[model samples]
Target: MSDSPHQMTPPPPEDEVSGWLRDRRGHFDQLVSSVEDYAIFMMSREGIILDWNRGAERLKGYTAPEIVGRHFSVFYSDEDRQSKFPDKELEIASAEGRFTVEGWRYRKDGTQFWASVTITAIRSESSAVEGFLKITRDLTEHRATDEMLRRSEERFRLLLESVQDYAIFMLDPEGHVMSWNNGARRIKLYEENEIVGRHFSIFYPPEAISIGMPGSLLAKALKDGRVEDEGWRVRKDGTRFWGNVVLTALHDSKGELRGFAKITRDLSDRQQVEHLRETGRRKDAFLATLAHELRNPLAPMLPGVDLLLHAPHDVATVTGIASMLKRQVDQMAHLIDDLLDMSRITAGKIALRHTVLPVREVVDTAVEASNPLIREFGHRLTLNLQDELMIEADPYRISQIISNLLSNAAKYTPPEGEIALTVSEKPGPMLEIRVTDNGIGIPKALQHSVFELFDQGASGSSGGLGIGLTLVRTLVEMHGGSIALFSAGEGQGCEFTVRLPVITTSAPAATGETPVIPSAPRSGPARILIADDGRNAADILGLFFQMEGMETAVAYDGEEAVKIAANFEPDFAFLDLGMPKLDGYEAARRIRRMYPRVILAALSGWGAEDDRRRSAEAGFDVHLLKPAKPDDLREVLRQHG
Candidate 1:
């Protein structure tokens, strides 16, 4: 460094060079040069490098012989040079005695590196600037790490700011607010500026704070890493809300406690629901409700169990019966299980599995589930398919909807009444289904509340758990549809119209079972014809009854069965209504003429009052929904006696 008006050690003798650099043994240079991590050198006051040490050579990729006496501006980037920044450093150092900066600098290879450079002005004893001492350190790696950390922190900040639901923030070791997020601001009703650095206990109610809740929570989190609580949290406006809070301990990699992270969620709606249930609703008398709910699932199962016990050991027959019973039982279970999913529905959590399916398949499946109830009422179900169409919907929920409506109709309808299910396309892309029943209809006054929770009907005949219609309406709406009820007056007829969205989906109109018209002529007429659509259902049942002794003739379609009965003249006749050529109804009517005193049992899918009346009119002494059970065969003898 050349001496300037400023002095390096007040400038040595005027004629002699400064001893700082003019060392006889080169010891001063050796010490500076040995430090490879720093570039230590001297520069003339005019900004030209006068000497370069080993550290400078190593850091700038130039040897002393190659770089000595070169202008220091050569190491500065083009932008810095264009702005005269290198000269400015010299000027600032000349005037202020020292200048320091961290910026981009270049090496001998022209590659850029972050450099911390300091320039110190040296002056002669006469107060004239002579030279300068400069030092440079490579900080590229350190700068890179700092930049990466800065970006990560920025992203974390943005993520917290964007959240709007959960109140998330940070606390200091003593529970003072360290940071606040957008969610925290919204939920706690506190601005970031107003809340940060404040004690977290302020958010707690006076009682809670008096009890040391905030301090205790911090302690628990410090010990356990996390603590959770559901309690009242006071907001900025002094209003209180039910909140679910989680306090988690934050720690460094060294296992030292840093602070805490708090997350709060508003749960006031849930608390309000609990309060309403406590105050407005009363469900203390629950025994009858429990019985009704349990009875729903048991209706289709008990008969099957009784039959299987007394059934003969025919593998194929037993397998068929078991499989059928299992399917019916599974349907009942699935439907009843849906009724228990009200909690999920109310919580906005029930999801539907939508699929393109045939309307006939859906209708048949729902009817299968409601068969027991329909038969119990003896209602004649008439299905009218005005339009064979395909529908897009959640098959399970749709089945539940239709089954509920059918079950309700069966429960309220009178014996020997009529129930009809009609499917057609509406004006738009909607599939309309109407379930009409001529039974105990809803009174005009109670019709509006029928779909309300637990409002079954005015009559005691609408026997059920009373959640069916409510469930049906909810399920119907979930499929992007609506359900409506209509009835003229009591004892008239009730109708439910459900309109559902119909997507342009391709599917065969009828992929379900083919309806059978009564017809009988087996491979060989053995004086008996047993007809059942189920594979081996009739054969297995007939074989089982035969092993019990007595000449019990298993009949097919009512009269097709009667034709065989004419030749066989069996005293006991078991007839299925869905026979070919002649149904069990007509067969029974025909057979009763031939043998007036014969014991006849009508095998029906359901036994409604109307069904029993029709069977009796057809001359059947007894009718059973589950005709496969031993109870039915035994019931035949019991009725005869």
Candidate 2:
């Protein structure tokens, strides 16, 4: 009873509103629960989960019942747990109001995922510590995508560095080079350090820069997304070369202009090749025309010379005329043959009638051809050979090549000097043919161009065109052989060596039956058609045929021949392969069509294999090279006519 006074009565309730307090707290919890993209939860003072929402369940693969009572540390990966990141996060939150981090987290199944976590400390109204609340979002997919994109970009950069043949690089919008590839380095002869940051205009020639072509191209690319050009461009050394250039503008994500990608290719070599081809084609055409025009008249001259030789006259006068005719005709024939040979070689018409023949036979044939020329030059030729050395080659071409070499020796050698010709078996599958002359040697400067068409060196003589060596090279190479020219120096003598492959032997006879020289023609009148481009040639041919007791009609060009042949129905027709309106080949085709049975002979300066094939296809019965001797012409005509 004494202490009863000390018992205090229950104090009156302070001004408090219970229902509103509960309502506000419930609204805060509902706000946390409504966050669908973040794993929002509340933890107790002991780091245990106090509340879990749908966001937490969806992110961590757990329900409220499974995770609400669990310690918050369960969300940390093993490495994070060992490092005590969960406690550290709580400590930081307790001291600094909140702790936020992006790191790997774990699910209920223990698989890890990237998480963005924000932690906050909950405190009592009196400032007593309560628990931490954490919000986390799964960012694994987004982070993985970012990492993959980084790797892809690195790979693209590497790929650009490895390319060659194209100068692939980037330029800034202002036309400054920004990137360099290996191709750019090689073509510009500059390293990346030296080239990058330089203006792209530096690659253009000064003339191009004066015209603003470089800047203009950049502006075009920026406006139209791409620009292309080709012309002479300058290199680092100031040498100009042909270049093919392309520029493409780059853009950012929002389509704002970024930079340009430029590519350049060098084409100087291609330009040179096309130029040479054009030149060669023109020269071939001109020579072919000249030969046809010049040879058509010679055709009639041969027959006329034959008639004079047979006519009743003083033996001395007839002999004199005959000798003169033979000499002039021989010269003309040689010139025509040279022209035709060049044409045939260029047209790829020469056919190889390959035969296995003794190397000595070829030498002998070449020696005979060069004997007259050698005698004229007062040059001594020493012929040396190994017996029965056989080679597989076109006899005509090999003989022609050897003959050309011997003639060259005779033409260039000093009078009374010695020329040595040797045929020997070379080691391993080749027959070595060597012709060394004590003559005016080729200049060292001219050696490189010696084999080129029409390349002539200064021999102090001007009568011959410089085509023999070229023809020799062509024929030799066509036979899969090679030729080399050597000399001590100019005026010190020149030597040519030809090496040709040897075939397994069982060679042809050393000497074959001599070609049956055509007998003199019967004394009878015959009809003839003469086609030529030169008027003098046509008249000369007409006179010759008339003296031979043969009626001849002349046509100045191929077209006229076709017309005259159709009307006159001549038994013998000589059609020049090269004519003004219609070429000889075409005219031959037309005449053959009209008179299938008439003997069609092709007289051309071009006597290449391709020429022969085309003439044959066009129904020419015989292909005669220009400047043919009168007797030879008769032989060709008699066989075909």
Candidate 3:
């Protein structure tokens, strides 16, 4: 050992270390000064700016000499300076070793820019705070883009909340409901707490769920980006509604499934409107057929009447002609009655006269009414009656319903076919009437729709107005009963079953006496006025009243009727609703003001419930449809009399 401790080549002097650090600092300064995108500067521990780079000078529009020794708070906005944010930032940086924030800053020219800033504390070897290294970047454009995106999202959310017609919602990847909007609540009748986190399939009907339609729709949306469908959906209350649905698949930037956006609109009203349009078209067709049907009977009646008028007065010849005329007239009347019944049913104007009646009587009446047609078709008929069965029903309408079914069977069945009508009592206090025929049957497609208006079976070759079954269904429903039809297909026999609630009460007392309508006393010849737009109709009606021992006046228009009534002071007036020159409504009002005691009656082709309401409002006591039978007019006269 040459000398004392083997000295490591005397440790580098402290001066040398200091020189090396200074050189590194110079290099860092050069590196930072060269950058133009970010402003780099130095601040004293007191928040006073000391050094500024080229980037800082360019961004703040201040030269190094102009900014040096200035307070760094000059770069902050006035509000931030008032709040002492610059000092707080420096204090926080010194204590925590660093502070970063983004906010508004001012340039030398007083202009503003959004800025991202970072302040890092410098420390001495003794761990004492020395100064701060500050880095800032102008981010006005990025801030603007972010603000625009935030506002756009807010607008979309508001739009979804405000919508009332369409249900807009989101679903998770597995079809769980994620979000629901106001419209979703309105349409689907579900609150967010009740629906969210549940499966989206809750909106599907049982039939749709059975077929996995909700999952299928999701899959289709995922595969095709979007899917649209129109079908029936169930509400929270389990009532079904027609819905127009659209499902759109959502994806991340990588094209992976994120979820789905579902939009649903209730289309029940639109569907109803379309149904009405379809019904109108069918009604037009039915009307055309009705014209032909009316002509069919009228054609024969005209020739037969001509023959009777010109032929010899032989007893056999007169009797045969009279029978033929009666048959044709009866046929025409039957057709007209059916048309009127359908109209009344559609207008909700048919009032049922309900009573407890024996089922046997109902069956017998229907059978008797249908006998002529059954014989004409040569069908073998069978009847099985449960004599103990009684139902609270509109006896006439019940008989009509059964007669319609029987007639339908006779018309569809081939000659010599077999038909059976059976009555049975079920345990639910219900009575069932089944009518079956070995005839050309309804197609399977039509079985469900056979009760709809103008829905004729495929095998319905026998011409008809196609309203009989509709009327039957309506009448059955009015009695709180239901009717169902079953058929395998065309050429297979069909069965129609009707079920009605049974009444436990005894049958009503029967009275063979007919009702006698009391007529007005003929103090003198009763004065009457007839108003109609149809000249011939007015004259003929007037003549009929005259023949019935009444003084009558005829007017061609409502205005003329009012004028005539001003002088005639008639005891009764029949006003047509659709006469030219001031309609019957106005005419009646005027006549009522002048002669309040006159018995007013409305005679018009318009026979709807609304029509009757208008007539009553116009002071009419009676409303009769056009082509009123003589007996109906006589009955009205008798009541008023």
- Residue 578 alpha-carbon offset, candidate 1, angstroms: 53
Please give the distance, in angstroms, between residue 439's alpha carbon in candidate 2 and its true position after superposition. Answer: 2.0
What overall lDDT goes with each candidate model?
0.75, 0.76, 0.83
Mind giving the per-residue lDDT tens digits that candidate 1 earns over 1-641?
A: 33321111122333344444454215445467556788887776677665666677778997765666678999987888899999999999999999999998999998989999999987776776777889999999999999999999999899988999999999989999999999999899999999999999999999899899999999999999999998999999999999999999999999988999999999999999986674334232133554665676577567766776777676776787777676665545444454456545766667786677777788889999898778877889998885457877887788888888888888888787888988888888888889999877878988877776655477742455567788888888888889988999988889999998864457644546444222233353223335454436777777766666544455434444666778887555777777777887777777778777665667776544556778898887667664355655666555453
lDDT of 2 by residue, 1-641 (tens): 12121111121122321232223334446577656688887666567775666678778988666665668888777787899978888889998889999888888898889999999877766665566678899999998998899999889888878878878999988989899988888788888999889898899877788999988998899889899998988878888878888899999999988889998988789878976885586457546645654565467667767767677486775777667666556756665677677876777766788777777777778788778878988888888888867777777778888888888888788788899988888776787889998788888877777676655555532234567888998888887889998987888898999987755477574555445332224355667888889787777778877887788899999888888888887777778777899988888778877766667778776566666888898888788776445676677565654
Candidate 1 segments whose C-alpha is farther than 4 A from its true place: 1-25, 123-129, 251-257, 270-641
Candidate order by TM-score, highest to lowest?
Answer: 3, 2, 1
Residue 192, model 2, lDDT: 91
Tens digit of per-residue lDDT, candidate 3, span 398-499: 899999999999999999999999888877778888999989987776686778787666754265788889999888888888999998888898899998
Model 3 error, position 534 (Å): 19
Residue 631 lDDT in candidate 1: 56
Query: Measured by TM-score, how close is model 3 to the native structure?
Result: 0.59
Between prediction 2 and prediction 3, the one with superior lDDT is 3
Prediction RMSDs, each to the true structure: 19.6, 17.1, 11.1
Ordered by lDDT, highest first, the candidates read 3, 2, 1
